[model samples]
Target chain A: MTGSRRQRVAKAVFLHAAALVVVFLMAFPLYGLLLTSLQPESVIRSRELSIIPQTLYFEHFRAVLAEGHIVPLRRALVNSTTVSALTAVLCLLVGLPAAYALSRLRVPGRNVILGALVSVYFLPTTIFLIPMFVLLVRWGIDDTVFSLVLAYTGFILPFVIWILKTFIDRLPLQIEEAARIDGCSHWQVMIRIVLPMARPGVLAAFVFAFILSWVEFLTPLIFTSSLRMTTVALGMFRSTIDIQVGQQAAAAVLTLLPVALLMLVCQRLITQVLMSGADK
Target chain B: MQAVPDSPAIGGQDEWTRAPGTLRRRETAFSLSLVAPALILVAGIYLYPAVYTLILSFARFDMAALEIGRWVGLGNYKALFANAAFVDAIWRTIYFGLLIAVGATVSGFLIALLLNEEFYGRTLLRVVVVLPWAVPPVVAGVLWGQMFHADVGFVNALLFRIGLIENYRIWFGDGRTALHIIALAEVWKAIPFMVLFMLAGLQSLPPQLHEAAAVDGATAWQRFRHIVFPLMLPIIIPLMLIQFVWAMKAFDTIFVLTRGGPAGQTTTLNYFVYVEGFQSFDMGRASAAAYSLLVVTLGVVLMVTVLRRYAALRKATA
Candidate 1:
């Protein structure tokens, strides 16, 4: 009996140790990024590396955050925010009604529409890359954030609509029926009855759309030029090519701030969307 | 048909109270209208472009004139197949996919199983594990790139300090190591999703089965091999398939890390398309390559669907 008890204790200790190592390995890169960004250039450029910062450095942050610098970080952040916020808003504005139609009303060929959307969601972004670039450029919107908005809206709309549909599917039918009986139109039923009930899903879909757009690299990189139009992701990449490791790290940390905050607030909902097989 | 109910909120009360078929038709119109914008966006942005790309694949593109010159009829595809570099990219992409599918899934399973065991800080660990998922794919490239930098890289400094290497070597300057490093970046990002799925699968498992197994005096490995693994297979297969598809399409990390380089060694099919389309302006060949990638993705999707059906059939027969 004592031997079995001791073995169980040993197992627990081993498990904890293993968990610690996994977490440390998984998190060390991010920690290193932050540490490298904070350390002075001397420490950063040194052949020897230390996990701990000897002296704090603000120049990289200041330089990255400065106005009118190449791949200007402030403008990039603003552009990213504008594009991401627009993507989220546009997705909700367009996605909510479609989700409602698909979820509640008997839209014709609902399954087909849903399947096509899912397939498109699963399809490679490269399939649409060339034509989108040509079309956007031809339309004289290629270098604009609005162009990014249009592209991201189309890209993120499928996921948003799918998630919102799932959310609306869970909503009770009785409330909607009562609203319709009380002389509410279909739009009213959607806006007044189902919308409030599916608020969590709405928030989740919005945040998901926002984060998806925010972290995007391919579209912005392809669609936009000029430092003002640079996205945080693109800026980080270009900065690396410029060999500004400290600034690149600073840019990365700054770029990740909003996403980290969003995840903190809506971790469970985002996890649901991810595990729901959206293929992050 | 269900009765057309009152809908005073709509502007036309007579329209709502009109002939029953009219009201129903109007309702259907409303539903269709509600669904129209989304479908239009998808069709206009995705479907139209995708079809255009497919059509362009078989045609000769005149870059100067910026239009289709002639229908070459698989000329582009033939060119792609004939090119040794393109062939290498296809095989290299497959290799990268295999690495990620195996590496992420296995490590994900182990970490998830460890987390499944009761321990302090499990919640914290799960959160920390998911941090990578929040990092943008490009930023993940940045993190890993910085970590393995030749001069100040933590990997190099630590390896040297530990006597693993006499000197700090450029890891990305070589083809094989570059591809492996990018794969590592992707695997690191993908593990969170895999673990998330595995944990959900693990938690949903019935506790009594494990208890019964323990009562039978089965070793941990024996229980895992006999029961847990088999039960987890359904989840694992689809998860790996998804990972494989993501791996095949991996571009951002590769773009940041090597730009498909150290002499085009690490270029995947996706990166090949980017280079052909944008850099080389070989629109025709790029379109063909893109279609090939689509076919590969669709093949995986079909495989997953068929495998799932087969699994279901086997279970029923058993």
Candidate 2:
């Protein structure tokens, strides 16, 4: 008995120490980024590295907001928001019906479709960028936000449908059957009965789709050119290359802050969605 | 048994056949309507582009041609095979992929195991572990790039301050160290994802088994090796396979940090395709390279999926 107790205590101590080290390693880079961002320009550029900032400078944030370098920061924010929102809506608009059919219809080729969709998850966006760019040019939508949105929808729709289909599969079928028995049309059953029942799944899909679009770099990098369509992720790149470390840090923080906050707010939902056997 | 219900003279026969047929038609219409938008988007965006790329691989297409190209069957593939740069790029890509995938999976599994225990501030620690994943790839790449900068980077500065090095090292500028540095960046960015997946797997393990092993006087190492390791294989194998594929296709961090710099030491197959297609405007060769990547990725996926299924079957039988 004594030996067992000792073993348990040893395990606990070991785990705690390991966890502490891991936590520090995980947070260290962000801490470094923050420290560098807040330090004075001279201090940041100094040869000696300091773990802590000598002096905090809030002015960097102000300066970044004021300088309006490359593309204006506000424009990037709006562009990201608009593109992400549209992408989310488009994913739902396209994913919902397909998910429904996959879940409920017992349709032929459903398994094949599911497999095809899952394969899309593995496709590297970089390989598609050139062809997609050419296609966008051919369609006369290159360098436009529309093309980005379309690309995002195409990229995310498969995974969204897969996830939503799993969620819908778990839902009880009696509700839809009852609605059908009441002389309701298939559309009515979907909108009134099934959708309301699958609200969490829908919301989960929307959040994932939106976050992905918001944080996406390659598509926007290759597809869009002008300030009007520049996303925050691309905007950060454009601004950072000019040696605006402070402003770039601030922009990075801003771009990352909302998604972090959203994840925290929806932590449970996000965790559930992630942990579910749906493809990443 | 219900033959009496066939009262066709009373208008029942027409109603029976017509109603069933109409229902079938309605079901078909509903299914198609529900699927049309998704199909159209997938076909137009993904399928069309993928097919077009395959077709372009066979042609002598260039930017000057502006979408009008002559057929040059096998020319591009031949050139890609003959080109030393492309060969070197493919070799580097595979090396980088293996390094990152194995490194991330092992490190992540260790971290997950440590985090799985009851500990102080476990929740906060979990959140911290997720931080690397939350940061966008571009941000992560840039952050690492800035950190490794020769003069201003904190890494060299810290090393020099600690008297570990006499001179500042140019980490990203050297061909030998550049790919390794990029690999490290890839591993750092990907480790969190591996941890998240592995953590979920770890959490699902039964505590009773561990207790039983302990009661049987199994040493900690033995318990892990004999019990936990075997059970976790089902999850770990799949995770490793998926991560391997992801590593093979990794591009963003490399692009942001290295751009296959220092004489293309870090250029992966994906980057090679990007440059050939976008930079050089050599669509034909790029397409061939892209198809090569697709074939390799598909082969890996097929092999892993089979391995996973076999493992699953063995588990069931056992």
Candidate 3:
């Protein structure tokens, strides 16, 4: 018995060691970037990259702030937050009902419509990018945050609808029926019974929508032409592409912050979505 | 995992049990109202322009053609198919996509298999695994670009020290290496998402099958081959399909890293569309190429669906 117990412990140790190696491999790139953010340009240029830079200091962060990263970041944070929050809110407003209809109320051709909606997004976003640019230009909303919001709402709505449908499918229709029997109006029953039950899913939908838009790169890239108008993600990209090394590294860190925080806060919920299965 | 919002004990009991009266009609109207805004939004923003892209493809809609909106009747598509560069771009897109699909599947399988074990520091390991999934694709590109840059590159330095090379190998300089390097970055960025789906599938698996197989003197490989793989197909198939499409559409990593450089060797269909339409102002041809990409995606999806159905049918019969 003791001999097998030793083998069991050995197996556990081996498992842990292998897992640690994987964790290190996965985390190493970002950690390397963080270390790069601290190093001076000269040391960074020496071509001897280490886990921790030899001449590490806080100067890069200071330099990044001194450059235009801080101001644009402020605007971008506000812009990203507002657009994402609004996207989430708009998605919820429109998505909840569609989801409810699909899940509960017998809307004719609902399955076909839902399937079509999903398949539409499966086509490359580029399929829409060119025409969208033309459309937005004609509408005169090009280079504006409103256009970004509308574009994001359109893109994220289907995902929100899909997720909300999953949630609403799992919800009890009897409560809503009970509310209807109790003389509550349809919208009222939705608000009072179904919506209350779906709060967590709604929040998950909102948070994920926010994160996706917050980190969105391409739409903002073409849609918003100017630096002043673009997102933090765009700023980070420009900082890197333009070879603003110190600022680029710093901006990389800044770009990661909101997403990291969101993941930290919402990972449990996110994993639940993952755990539930990706089929629908 | 967040508790699933309380489900009523009643199974599949729906809201239509009341009556087939005027009240039901009112409910239908309300439900239709509820779904109308989404339909409108989808139709206006998504559906409209997609069809417009079809129109724009067929018509001469370049700067000069923008004025006339003249119909060209397969002129753009003919040009696209005739262009060797565009045709080549199609092959490059599939090459990169297959690389990513295979990489993501293998690494995701490994990570899932590892995490499925009862290991110490499991939560911490999970966080580390998921860290990349949280990264903005742009940031991931930038970060990896820094590591792979010719001078001051970590890849070169480490490779040299480990005796993998005698000199610094410029990872992104050669056309041959650049595309694969970019694909590698994409694979790294994609691992977390793949692992998430895989872990979900892995966790849902029943361990009793493995235990019983082991007791029957089956080797580990046999058990996995004969049991785990078949049971895991439902989850892995959808995840891999999604991964294929995503990798095909992926633009950020390669764009940031190479911008389809070294004589446009790394350019894919997605990039082809962006450059042709936005950069070159050849709206008509770009639209044609974009539609071709869409067609390829649809064709793949259709093929895979049929294949999976056939496999399932065969298995059932067997």
lDDT of each: 0.85, 0.78, 0.80
Q: Candidate 2 lDDT, tens digit per residue, A201-279?
A: 8998998898889889878877877766788877766544565666667777777776877777777787786667533
lDDT of 1 by residue, A165-239 (tens): 877776677778776767787888888888999898999999989999999988887898776689988886554
**What is the DockQ (computed on Cα atoms) for candidate 1?**
0.53
Per-residue accuracy of model 1 over B39-140 as CA lDDT, tens digit each: 998888899999999998999878776788899997999999999999998788878888999999999999999879887888899888888988888889
- The true-versus-predicted C-alpha distance at residue B87 of model 1, in Å, is 0.5
**Can you rank all candidates by lDDT, best first?**
1, 3, 2
Off by over 4 Å in 2: A1-9, A239-241, A278-280, B1-21, B302-318
Q: Count the backbone clashes (under 3 Å) in each candidate.
A: 0, 0, 0
The predicted structure with the larger lDDT, 1 or 3, is 1
lDDT of 3 by residue, B104-216 (tens): 98899989998888866887898899899888888888889877877776787888888898988778889878898888888899999888888877877788888899999
lDDT of 2 at A97: 92
DockQ of each: 0.53, 0.44, 0.51
Candidate number with the higher TM-score (1 or 3): 1
Estimate candidate 1's RMSD in Å. Answer: 3.6
lDDT by residue (A1-280, candidate 3, tens digit) is: 9998998999898898889789777888888788788887777777554665566678866765553653366667677788888888999999999887777775767767877778876788887887888877777789998999889888889888888888877777677767666667667777888898988788888888888888888889889877678687876554334745655777788888888888889888877764553643
Where is model 3 more than 4 Å wrong at Cα?
Answer: A1-10, A53-56, A67-71, A238-241, A277-280, B1-19, B64-68, B309-318
> Evaluated on chain B only, what are the TM-scores of all the candidate structures, in order?
0.90, 0.88, 0.90
